[model samples]
Target: MSEFTSMAFGSAWGVKDWDESSIAPIIAREVQNSWRVRGMGDFAVGARECGSATGMLEKWKVLREDEIQKLEDVKWIGYVGVRDATTTSMAVGDTSQPTTRPWQQMIELRYGFHPEVWGKGFGTEAAKAIMGWCGKYIGAERFIAEIEIENLGSGRVLSKMGFEEIEKEKEVIWGMEGTKEWKIWVGR
Candidate 1:
C-alpha cells in the first residue's frame, strides 16, 4: 500500500489506509444498507444477491493480489476515503480489471461513508480529492464509475466532479439486478 495524506474539506479530513481486515466490515455494512436509500437501495439489493462482501471479497482478493504484482506496469489509479481530520475512513481505488477498452481503467469507489453523511457535500469533496489523487499519484488519465440508473445521488456527485454521461447499458452482474452504466472521464 502507498502512503496517504490528509485532504482539506472546509475542516480537516485525512485519508485512511485500507487493509483487508479493516475494510471487510465496512464493506459488509455498506452492502447491507445500500438499497435502503432512494437511489442506492437497488445496488444494495444487488449486493445481497451476489452474497454480499463475503463473496465479493473472495473474488476481489485474488484480483488485487494479481494486480499488485503488475502494479509497476499498470497505471496508478486513485484512493477512495472519508475524512474528518481526527479520523479518516476510506478505501483505495482498484484499477486491475479490464472493464472498458484496453487503455481505459476502472476505479471502484467502494465503501464511502455512512448514509448519515449523505447530502452533506462530503461525497463531492471526497470525489474531487480522489480525482486529484488519481492525477498526482496514480497518473490516471481517465476513470469510469458504473452506477445504477436510479442512483441519482451518485449521478449528481459525478456531475459535480465534471463527469459527463457517455453511455448507458444494462448489466446483470449484481444478482441479476439490472444496472445503469455511467462512464466518467477524469484527467486529460
Candidate 2:
C-alpha cells in the first residue's frame, strides 16, 4: 500500500486538501447569494449572521481560532474538496477575493459546492468519502450527521450512505455556518 492517508474515495470521487487553493469561500458566498441558508429550519439556530458576504467575512474571522483548536484536538477531519474543478460557474465573476473559513468544526464532516454542481452527485460522493474516513480512523463504533428535517437532499444522501434516523429532535448544529432544528442521522 502506498502510505496511508486519512482521505479516501466514494464512488467516482476523490478527496483533495481544501487549503489556500480551495474554492470554499467563493462557494460559501454562492450559497449565501442563492439564499440556500436563508429562513431554514423551524427553530432559530445560530446567530443568523451568515446571510451576506459581509456577515460571512465576520464569520471567517471567528472561525480561525476554532480551526486551529479542532485540528490540534484531532477532532477535525479538515475540509476536503472533491477533486473536480470547473470555474465556468462562478457567478461572482471573480474568485480572487474568495475566503476560506477556518470555522468549520473540523471534527465534523462538512461540505460545500457551487449551486451549479447541485444534483450532480458530487455532494453525495464527497460526503461518502468523509464518512468512510470517519468510520475507519475515529475509533468510534458510531457516527452521526445532523440534517435539517426539510433538507431532503442531505437526508437522501445520508440514507443512501446507510445512515438511519435514531432519534428526531430540534437541535443546533454549529458548523462553518449554523443550522437549526435538524434531524439527526446515525450509522449502524
Candidate 3:
C-alpha cells in the first residue's frame, strides 16, 4: 500500500492494494462512461463503440481474473481506488481510474480523475504508485502512454511522471483506429 496523499488538498490519498473485489467499481465506472470504455482497446474499431458493446460483462469477468493474475499475463494490470485518508471511503472525491496499454506490450499508462479532484495532485500520486509497482514487480522498464489531442490534463500527469513525448516517431497507437492519432509519451 503506497501512501499517496494530496498536498494540494491537504487530504490523504493512496493506492489501495489490488484486490478481486475492486472489480465491481472499476466495471461500474467503465460502464458509466462510454468514452472511458472506448479507450480500453478491446471493442471493435479498436475502441468501444457503445456502453452496451457485446460481451462487456463477460469481458470484464475475464478482466477481473486477469487483474488478479496479472503477472502471468503479457501485460500486468493493477487497480486501486483513491480513498479518503481519514474514513477510507470511496465516496470522497475518489475518482481517478488509471488506464494502461495492453499487458502484452510496454505497459503504457493512462488515467482519469473526477473533475473535482483535478489539480489537487491525486492523479499524479496514483500514477507514480501504479508505475512504481509495475516497474518493481512486473519488470516494466519503460512506461508508454498515448494521450488524445485534447486530453491535456492527462498529458500533464504523464509529464509529472517524467514521461516525455516522442515527437517524431509517427508510430500509431496500438488498437486505436483510423487517422485520429494520439500523441505518444515514453518514460524510462
Candidate 4:
C-alpha cells in the first residue's frame, strides 16, 4: 500500500485495508450516480450492466465482505479514493469489471469531487497518479475506460492522460437506449 502513498491526496486519503462497511458506501454512491445519469434502473441494473460489459459482475454488482476480500487479494488490481484536504469530500477510482479480452485489463476510473473543487486540476492529478501506480505496482500493461460519448469533460481528462480512442458502440445496459460509449486505452 505504500506505493499508493505517493499519489496525490493519498497520504490524506488513508487506509490500507478495506471491508464491506467501508467500501459499500463508495460503491453505492457510484452506482447511484451511474444509474441517475445513465438512466440505469438502479444499483442492480448498474451491476448487471457492468457484469455484461466487463464480466467482473461480482465486483460491481454489490458490496459484500467477500467482494472486498477478493479485491484486496488481486495482486494486479489497485483501488483508491481522492479527497479534498480541507473539506474531506472523496472520489473513487481503481477498479471496474475485468475485461473480457485477454490482452488488456478493463478498468473504470470514476471521480467525484465537491462542487467547490470542480474545474481544478485535482482530478487530472489524481488520475495521473493512479495511472503511474498501475504501471509501477500493478504491472498493468494496459488499461481501458468506458465513458458516455456525451461526457466531454471526462473525454478531456482521458485525452490529457494520453488515452486514445479505440472504439465506440451502442450500449443498452443502463436502461438507456442508444448510449454511445467510447472505449479508450492507455499503454503501448
Best by lDDT: 4
lDDT of 4 by residue, 31-131 (tens): 66544432321111112224344444234332343643343422222232311111111122313442233332433444433333334554566566555
Residue pairs in collision within model 1: 35-41, 76-138, 81-90
lDDT of 2 by residue, 36-78 (tens): 3221111111122334556422332123324442333221212
- Model 3 accuracy (lDDT, Cα): 0.41
> In model 2, how large is the Cα lDDT of residue 169?
34
Q: For every model shown, what is its TM-score relative to the native structure?
A: 0.42, 0.35, 0.40, 0.41
Task: Using TM-score, rank the candidates from best to worst.
Answer: 1, 4, 3, 2
Question: Which of candidates 3 and 4 is the stronger one according to lDDT?
Answer: 4
lDDT values, one for every candidate = 0.40, 0.36, 0.41, 0.42
State residue 34's C-alpha deviation in candidate 4, in Å. Answer: 18
Per-residue lDDT tens digits for candidate 3, residues 114-144, read 4544565656766676555555555555555
* Model 1 C-alpha lDDT versus the unseen true structure: 0.40
Measured on C-alpha atoms, candidate 4 has an lDDT of: 0.42
Candidate 1 residue lDDT tens string, 1-188:
11212111101234566889999998777645442321121111011112344542122211222433434422222224311111111122323332333232444343243343446565665566555655565544555554555556667887777766643234211221233334455543
Model 4: residue 13 alpha-carbon error in angstroms: 26
How many pairs of residues in model 2 come into backbone collision?
A: 3
